[model samples]
Target: MDKRFIEEQDVIFNAKPDAVPYNYRISYKVAQVCLILAKSCWGKSGCLPIKLHMISFALCSKEAMDKLLIFTQSEYAEVPIVRFDPAVNSAVTFGIADGLIFQGQNGKYALTDKGRFFVSKIEKESTVLSAEKKDLSLLSTKLTDAKIKQLSDIWRNIYAED
Candidate 1:
């Protein structure tokens, strides 16, 4: 109705079909890292929490019935709920539960030896963890190839497997 509103609508209309804010890419990156770490440390000893179960179940449902979809008409649905939290939280929370990391004396979260073994592909120049290593390398390269070397050690330590 107003001049400012009209201009804003015009910009939205002309934007690319899949356009998203920069933060979306960054958050998506973080989500991927979390999933990778979780899969690396996967165990069948326990069940996933309700939120995770719902998201997983919904994601596999009929497209129109999928609550996890970006767009949904259900009254209980949130326009964009349940992404960064489950991925990131499960990574850290399960890491602790699985003895993959611990709180150091200095209050820093440090990876346990078991955790370090999982991400060891980034260091020690080994090819044993080929799949994981390749995935991590590609992801880091996408983020910034120059800095991946600098970050490799830290990534290996933080994302080691069970």
Candidate 2:
């Protein structure tokens, strides 16, 4: 159509994209994982299966919680399907690379000393992640690996049958 308009469109297409938002940044996600581990781990071990981490992270979202609450009260009586966010793996990898966390042979992730210190800082702030901290605290150790796996199996079975 118009030559100048085509050139302008090309420039727009080549422009650099905006930076990832603070909530999606790896450092911020690492902090979120560490806080989750600190609050939700069953014992002093401060370790959790990766799948459970996904669940806990999903629970941090108000939307996810609302859907879960409604699902629990519904008559279908089926296992709730959780949406797994793949971005969490990057945060976990960054934590391991930075020595903030470690993955065990048992496939569980536990915070290192440095990670604990980082989480302590986040905790002391009281303003950052306040809502997530409160939600995770209320859900401490309630979402176990076994329970997650059971739900996953049910989901797979239902989908597989269809």
Candidate 3:
């Protein structure tokens, strides 16, 4: 092995644990999933398929929020572009493990009573996820399950393009 390779390995091995990026942190993703469930799913019966969760999380970005707003205002005249995020699976799993989220018989995810209480705490803070809170509240229950299904089909078509 080259001397440089050994030095790089030493550096990596000796490095201390760094802080995880906010997006990748389990707690952050869990909170995001819970907030999405509370705002988007609760009104419709407190559950949404994993696809909806992925799409909803994708919309959390400021750019995606703009797209979502346009879609909502235009009455879905055109399908807005949305991308699937696999990272949401990890978050959902963590939520399930912690008893903050549950899967229904239909394989949809919903907030548990514990999850609702956690969300209440998040809501009362008025600081955590403040921008996301505003955005999600504006979108509460607007993207129905049927609409989400349509959106997924549209997304599939978009990705299928050569």
Best by TM-score: 3
Each model's lDDT: 0.36, 0.63, 0.68
Instruction: List model 2 lDDT by residue over 1-162, tens digit each.
Output: 221101211211122267766666665677777777777764445465545445555666776655444443453444555655556777788778877788877667888877777777777767767887887776666656655556667778877765
Least well predicted 10-residue stretch by lDDT in candidate 2: 4-13
lDDT of 1: 0.36
Which digits, one per residue and each the tens of the lDDT, describe model 1 over residues 75-94? 33333323334444554455
Each prediction's TM-score against the native? Answer: 0.27, 0.72, 0.75
List clash counts for every candidate, in order.
Answer: 2, 0, 0
What digit string (tens of lDDT, one per residue) describes model 3 on residues 1-162? 221101211211122277666766666677888888888887426566544554455556877776666665665566665555555778788788878889887778888887777787778767777887888888776677666667667777877776
Stretches of candidate 3 off by over 4 Å are: 1-19, 54-60, 75-78, 155-162
Q: Candidate 1 at 93: error in angstroms?
A: 0.9
Residue 112 deviation, candidate 2, in Å? 0.9
**What pairs collide in candidate 1?**
118-161, 119-160
Q: Quote the lDDT for 25 in model 3.
A: 60
Q: Which prediction has more favorable TM-score, 1 or 2?
A: 2
